[model samples]
Target: MTTTDVHVFFLLLCLFSPKVAAHGRIPTTLDGPFSPRTRRFDPSLRLGSDDVPMDDPKLAKKVGFNFPEQIALAISFSHTSMWVSWVTGDAQIGKNVMPLDPSTVGSEVWYGEESGKYSFVQNGTAMVYNQLYPFEGLLNYTSGIIHHVRLDGLKPGTRYYYKCGDSSLKAMSKEHTFETFPTSPDHFLRKIAVVGDLGLTLNSTSTIDHLSKNDPSLILMVGDLSYANQYLTTGGKGVPCYGCAFPDAPIRETYQPRWDGWGRFMEPLTSKIPMMVIEGNHEIEPQARGINFSSYLTRFAVPSLESHSESNFYYSFNAGGIHFIMLGAYIDYNQTGAQYAWLKKDLLKVDRELPPGLWQLGILLGDGGNIEQIDIEHADDPGKCPSKNPSIPEFGGICHLNFSSGPAKGKFCWDQQPEWSAFRESSFGHGILEVINSTYALWTWHRNQDAYKESSKGDQIYIVRQPEICLANIAKVSSKDQ
Candidate 1:
């Protein structure tokens, strides 16, 4: 048979597979009230890995002072624009430290399709952040001048070359290149990587290397961008257990420099592809006077305002035909709270029918506290509830609360899987959503333990959109209307 015919045959086979079901943990349509399944974690994968040391070459500052370091990219509200960010200057760590004057170094980006030929220029703003510990023996920390510039009026599915820093100061980044996402919703983005709780560890390097080979157009870091708080001081030896070893400490010790190290390590990939991040518990580095989430709030820029959400903790963005909503589990999520109100409005605004064949994917991370917790309403079997609460308080405030209504109402843990939860697993894995058409999309989750070539998928499903049903709901009049 010809290549086209073979492709058609394979497509038909996938569509007809009996093992494939519609919606829930597996990809499915709104037609879900499906039974839930939980796969036990393999004993071999339970051991925690060590973080990459500060002195590692990959984590070192490759560029000189005043030159761009930790270069990265993030998606704007649309594919036509993208945000590029980086740091320039030396961070200070001592009892008495001064922050770099952001104005001292100008922030600029020069780019075009050709090398050494600057066709476009964009200027942006810069600032520095500090982690202060007033108590003696605990070192205070300050970051380098961080810059963020947005590139606009660009065509999608096209590659662009660029460099950043103060050109007049002889501080310019090495030439780097990145490709934009496809403009057409019908076109498929080959691979999109998703990962969470990815500390700077040897295993993290392995994960990054494997994900790099996949050539994902975008990356969704569900949370825990950098486990800097796991350490007591900048560049100090990170203890295996923080709460166990440092019980009497005023606050959990954090190695702020690790954030820079992580940035340097991820620059190679992030410089080219857009990465969207959500706040994880590890990001909530607390300080004096009841302060919290300082590191997370200052380091990354998310589309909270652009997406119409007021807080960075939660936001939504579109990739091809998929609409992804990243929720904040650490913030107030009660039905009467601001986040809940915002979410309701956001959900009401979605015209899923507009993006023909598009599917909706909601990813939840950091379920320790009262704001967001695992839904246990519909487990396939009893006595399988997670015994250990992995909710580490140092990461952030407790937000997980008991359900007021539903089958699992008034209970801290659900007896079975919740109706709203299609598939629930407590493993660290990333998912990829491939939009095949306006009506059908393929969803797959890859567990970290699975070999790169083996394709040992944790879950796979085809998401089907029913515009007819959605439109009917939109047309219905509520009791308030009467």
Candidate 2:
């Protein structure tokens, strides 16, 4: 037999071996163009998927006035710097609500490699935002002071302790610690957790609990964060879809307090590990005079200027040897647009030898429990295909087209699962990504239900890279540029 044929035979034997199965061997991408798989949704789980109430200790304010609360960390452009953020004072909601003076509270972070021995002090800006609705029966909301301070020129892969607050007022926060990502390509970040559409729900807690157990170094939150817009000015149970519930409302109503609650909910995990975020439709909380995304913009600190993108909606950052490009779906993405131009420039700077290029593979990480309900409907499923313009997006267009090729040729909906889908499940979960080396990375999905079975992983695989072919293509692109 030919060499390629012999290699294939050995791979098939190893994959089907009972011993390998018992040993929990993870399949790699080279395994095949896998057949589509659909795990049946569990009916036993409650379908209501209600939002966790604000009264929960996890969502309540933990600090006194002018003291830092809802603290979080974010990666700067590189490992030499890290961004620290938190909120101070109480947010107000109602008519005639007065905005907090950010000047009242100082934004500072005192940090050093050793515990309680701060050698460096960094001061940053503080700001507050308001969400207003001019229509009748709607209330205006003002936010607490949001602070973001960047700690710079630090040793990579080292632990540091810090506190944030107005030190002069003796309102300093309790000490917190975080480790920086390594700068070398030879070493990898411990683990990177990825989740999307995570709302404030019981299922969300399960997902977060499962993720926290894994102890990830970084988090990539692909947005749909708080679901704040799912409620009215007078807070109530979050709706599955804002448009469906408030079709005739004058403007999209938002209980801005939900954002604060979400900040508090995420502090436990985000305070140490940096969470990089991109905007999702749920973040567009529209209010008076076309104002939108006020809370989202003011609350988070991202490396926009460091990457030269200059927009919080999209940016790029590095952790260890890996470079991450976060694109904004809600922003201008045309070829002639500024975002597109920035993307082209960013792509050219990738270190092809160390970080390498990505292949065309789609991994859905959007099942992180949201009150909007788990997205189980497939465009290819019979009678389950979403209608064109089924719901209006806060931004952008939705186009539905019939498949030009594949088993369901010329069809708007497939009778069976599409061939492109490797595995599909309607369960809430989060994913962990671990780069074993420059060329190999492990991607594992952990289902919330699997918490009962600690050893159980819903799906696991090693995403392999074809360095010979892909790197050659990169060389050609480099030659063209030269």
Candidate 3:
């Protein structure tokens, strides 16, 4: 065949390939800046699950006073150190409630490499917080003394057994074990699980069960944990969405017991695996005197100080070769704000050969099978595009603005699918990130319905980094030099 004819045939074959558009084929960022696409919520699958009852055995406070009930672990500054936190004493909820003295309980943890044999005992700090609604008829809630003890000088990749509580009061927990991340050249931070908007629902339980079965070394709860704000101050059934009932109330009411229940429900997993968290909108349970984020700030732990971000709202942590920047959407994300400054410094420190998302060159994983069900709104849908100023930021100033340059220039919602968003699906799913090497990482999305179906994945992609290209670009001179 002639040279021209041969070239024409080759181009045609490439364009008509069947496998290229198939769902089974995994994609890479190298093939994009892709056109935006949105997948509508499935009609067959459930939109959401009912909140788990307080009477459920898993969420009940099983431990007695002075004993640790909601035991949890968090990664500190480095692999050599880890934080263990738990609660002691029974909480009180009534018209005239008194908070327990934190000093009443001696915070301590006994741990070692061997099971049932503790070689080290560490002392920690203890404190308590209260959620009070000044208005009448709204019962006040006080939390049990929360203890946080740090275990330094730990061996990397070694499994250590621990029990935390007030030993002086003869209250100590049963033995539990966890392994530290690998310290050296192996770069083995195995499956990192990511979940968002996880409320205390049967579907949330299913998500947790499936995630546990996957055996992830770490978990990142992006936000909206427990859904405690969905309840009334009286501990009665609340409206599904936030602030739907009693819109003009003085302050948003929350049943603080839901936090306790959530802590208990998560203890089984958090006790073994370090679950790092960032605050979400639901965590902003506004009370009198402008006190918000009380439960979220008090209950869980993050590598804020350790990572040098210092603020719990936004921070960075390294797991093997991957560096994660957990940004707080509820807080100040403005360019002039503290979070933005910290983020800029962090980006400068990151190997530029890395991916985007600040210019937001990152994946948006919102498919965590949540109780509120799957998201259905799409910017490109006929009437689904959201309006400007739809909602105010929970903690910081509302900074969402119109596009300066794009098809939707001067508009908040795009008229059509924007090119940046490669694809989106409204479903309940959790993502597992498997870092294979310094340059390649595989991300898989597991749907709620696909549990127990091995090799079944809703979305799979390989994130490839171009270090050489980034290095060359960094070394290149600016246009001013020309």
Candidate 4:
């Protein structure tokens, strides 16, 4: 799709805990549906920035041959278990590339409650993926061995030190530590960092730096991890608009190494904090023979099997008392699809008493300072609505339609800001979710520009849950798993 044909916008809906008190009385959702608020795009800052070079110290490989790099953590279906993933060896990209054999190296993790005291051992699986473009001039790419190990039979709300690598080769990594989420929902869930469309750019560094300062316990990455598709296989300079640069290319070209760079760049934070990710459009790196999402599928390990999910694109897990259901926007979400069936089954199993209440709310997050130009125009804005036939999706049908009911009934665009949009801005930033109690959660947004001011927040709100009013509806859905 051409640049003009695709206008991308990142949407994030997350719950967070309150770190600092608001300037004044914090508005809660119980205050009724508030009026729409809009923050006009800032003109001082450029709409976009260049991606961070692969040679940058943060992205460059720091590990030795056959050593673990890009180490990261992910949560399993329960608090008693967690997933550890890392990459070994070097990725190759050229006209003729050779793929690495995962079996050559072992996947193991050594962990214990105290530092330097080995108590438990776990062995997991390893894998590799290739991005090949057989067409002339396009280079092929093969990845390093990716390993994932799940550690089970662990206590909750406790700290554990660990190291990952192949012990046989004497290539064990340095020590790392992470605390498990509290088993009870009544316990306060610390900071949960939520970001979307986070590309590797100067702005991304700022975003991540500010996020790390908050010391979040868990991270919810709302897709669009790396904008690799904006680059060609040769990987010189990346473009903001893919179609504008190489319009005649046989297929969409991507620098697969960008994935490795992103993993290394994020290793500092992801190595200690569990990051749960759902696939975004950029991850669909299509290659020869109709292959797609090869890098995304093989690199990071999600709790798909533990959650009974058939695909890695979507899954669900619990952090404290909160059950997070991560949905895949690019996948089939129709009521007749497998995803819908899974959603139905999962929702039916929700025990309100475990978390006190299941209040349905939505929060959309974007503007995470990616290389792509910031999305300023809204569908409701004048001359911005989708045409009769919008750009067709890679896998789905033309589903865009005019509002059947609402202020813009029968029209594709609304003259004013839609009522559903509580607030909108074009600045690059990240959000933090804090669950204060069973009935309340504080949501705060931090702009990258105001990184120095810890007290400053772009937006803040309290999400109050009213079980008395919503419990009746929840009782209707009986648990099928029971």
Candidate 5:
């Protein structure tokens, strides 16, 4: 063959050669400690945005008694099932209030593919919670009947229309729709929005509106859900702090109905997509005999038991190729505590082989009270964390502790950033995880100020997992047992 013929053959080879595939790439811990390139907060995005008032028509219960209000969805332990929850009946607030028996209303869900055709029926459980303030000038509250039903055997990535209510009372909700997460770990999920300290403010409305349009497959709410504690009574006035201005007040107060309003506002997005929440300090609304977190514990359903977590304060779940571990800063997290023990075990159970994807672990920290000095002492050592606690009382709780060991041993503040904290930012914002492939995923944190555009990313990284690294550890353990 002539030289021209050889050149033609080489061109053919270049045109037909298979494209090189990008696979697993592991990142070193040293590759980070990345300082988020800072951008000045836009004057337009001030914290002055007020909370949407309860009387807003959008929050009012549109349907009659037994009709579903505050409708939302949450994932169960696995992709084969999901949970649907809603509230019914009129919540009452007054000096002499009557609690509605949960049994007074039937708990049921009617769902199927075809609209207006719910041939499939599922029955579930219901309950009511009360927030009592046995003090003069303080009002009492009994919630509407809340319903929770788990729908199982669902085909992932499939859409199913659903309506929940009491068939007997003809109190069914208007048809609502939701799509399941992708069944296969390899399948790509467009976006997963994450946020923390999301109070029900006008700014929050913008955040939710933008997030809804982004159309995430999942939502991870890291806590401080509603600022219900910033009120005087169940149906009374809104105050920034219960007794800050009135130090001698006889009772701590809360506007419990704000929670209902938050739920209703969130229904537009949460009803269609699953939202997984972890407690934040704002959730600890102390009332009656020092009872706390009553509204938070009752309002949302989490996969605590399903994930082997004895309490809802912390848990773990999987979405597509990602394994998410939600930790509770308000709970006991000492290396020797129950939550810490559970966390260590839970981390050990992560299986990177089946999915062959990068494992991402996330921790959300911040609340109004002093984090246990024990954890902080370790966190604040000159060789550990070199930062002081910027404590704010708006958030509640007293779980922060000083480190018992490490360079910061016995100190109350870290001299620098703690090693375990891969990244830290104080501004209120949310995060999103986009799985690009089996061994690689992209994570981004969008500050509330940057919600409109992607210009400012508070933190972003490509999390990579080396199966070889984790598998070797597993193998070593197996051999040691032998």
Candidate 6:
């Protein structure tokens, strides 16, 4: 869609640890519903930035056919097991592109706690995929061998050095290291950064660099990973508005090579820290015969079957005592859908649920008359509260409902700001959630423009949970497998 047709916003929500680092006390959620507070958008921080070129050094391929690149990690249900993925061989793009034989390359990983020492070895599967555009004049693309290996029976909160590639070809990747999440339920993972709508651009580089400086143990990517779909079937310079740029093209054309470039661009950070990702609309690269999600599905691995969700679109995983449910926004989230059904069961089984990035953080509220305008309206703003047909649904159900017991009971709109809205802002920013314990979590919102200007926060507060009040609602289920 054109830029005007598609007004998307990024919401960077970071889930952090309380004991990690803090300098002040904060308020809790028990202080009653907060009044609506708004921070106007800062004119200084440009909402848009230039995309990095495909040939940029960071996105350039650094390895040959036999060697592995894009080394990354994912949690396999628990810390006891992990999944490692990488790519080999050169991706081909042209009118006629042949797919690579994944079996030709052996997928293997060697790891140990100590450097230069070997204590464990694992062999995994590999495969290649293609994104074909059969329409005349459009280009077709084929991917390199993508590999995923699962390493199980490991200790948590421990560091492990490893290498992945075709061991037989002597083209294994150089040794890289990653640490497991904290093992104890009481212990928590510190410094998690969240981001979204991360196209391979100068802005994306800045965001990544900023996140790296924060030294996050894990990353929660909210979606719209790489905007490769923004380009045309015949690769050329990208435009900010896709629909306007290629008004005549058949379906949205994506430069598949951009995916490879993005993989390389993110390798450094991903290879070191475990990143959990859910799909965004951009991942749905529709191709021949209604096929889709080829790149997203084949490139990364998530704990779907492990979490018993059985679908990569949505799943739940635990990090110590905190359980994270990565929901695919592109998926059907209605009450009747399978995703909703799975979510119902998952939430019921939460032994302990503590709630929680910055990246992919897009606009939270855009101008009215579109899906992006669906926002948490301030009840006090006179004439601003929509009456009839107030809400609109995008890829999901219409969930607008009246509060049955709150101050706005029996009314679709409140006369004033809602107590639950402690604060709001129209600026581009990222938020960090620090869970102190089962009772309190600190949340701080950082504006993009003020990132380096003395650590000024646009919004900061503590979310205190009331166990006594909601204890009866807490459900218990078997955690034998989790």
Q: Judged by lDDT, which candidate is best?
A: 4
Clashes of each: 23, 0, 6, 10, 37, 27
Q: Per-residue lDDT tens digits of candidate 4, residues 1-482?
A: 00111212222212233334444688888886878877776677653667899999999999898899999999998889999999999999998988899999999999999999979999999999999999999999999999999999989999999999999999999999999988653465678888887889888888899999999988988877888888899995887767767778889889989989999999999999999888877788889999998988998889999989998888888777567887887778876799878877776566522434564644466556677757767766667775776433444467667779988898767878878777777777788887776567788988876645767888888887776777665565434323
* Cα lDDT, all candidates: 0.68, 0.78, 0.73, 0.80, 0.66, 0.69
lDDT by residue (1-482, candidate 6, tens digit) is: 01212223222222333443355655555665666666544455554556677778998889887899888898787768888999999999889999999889999999999998869999999999999999988999999999999998888888899999877799989999988887664666566565556667666676676667667777776666777888886667677656666777777788988888888998999998888887877688888888888899999888898889958988867665566777766777666688877876775555334342111223232211111211333444677665566323223446568768778788777775555555665433344555555555566655455654436776666655554444433323223224
TM values, all candidates:
0.80, 0.90, 0.86, 0.91, 0.78, 0.81
Give the poorly placed runs of model 2, Cα more than 4 Å off: 1-24, 46-48, 352-362, 405-409, 452-454, 468-482
Per-residue lDDT over 336-386 for candidate 1, one digit per residue giving the tens place of the 0 to 100 score: 688877765665556433423223345343211111112222322475544
Candidate 1 ranges beyond 4 A from true positions: 1-36, 45-47, 234-241, 318-324, 335-358, 364-428, 454-456, 467-482
lDDT of 3 by residue, 275-380 (tens): 8887877788888788898988888767788767857888876654456677876666666688877765676656354433121224465455445565566655
Model 6 CA deviation exceeding 4 Å by range = 1-22, 352-421, 426-429, 451-454, 468-482
Candidate 5 versus truth, CA RMSD in Å, comes to: 11.5
lDDT of 5 by residue, 1-482 (tens): 00000000000000011222353453434377654232334454455546677878867778787789899999887777788999999988888789899998888989887788876888888988888888888888889998999888788878899999998988988899988777553465567776655667765776676676667898877776777776768454544444554565565577788888888888888898899887766677777777878887888888888879988888877665456677776777766688877765665566422433334344242311111100112333346543354334433544567768875678666465555555443344456666665555566666555546645666666765565785587568656645
Q: Which 10-residue window in model 3 sums to the lowest lDDT?
A: 4-13
Q: Best candidate, TM-score-wise? A: 4
Name the weakest run of 10 consecutive residues (lDDT summed) in model 1: 1-10
Candidate 3 residue pairs that clash: 356-361, 356-362, 357-360, 357-361, 357-362, 367-429
After aligning candidate 4 to the native by TM-score, how far in Å is the CA of 326 from where it should be?
1.2
**What's the C-alpha lDDT at position 54 in model 4?**
90
* Model 5 regions lying over 4 Å from their true place: 1-38, 42-44, 234-243, 344-358, 363-429, 450-459, 466-482
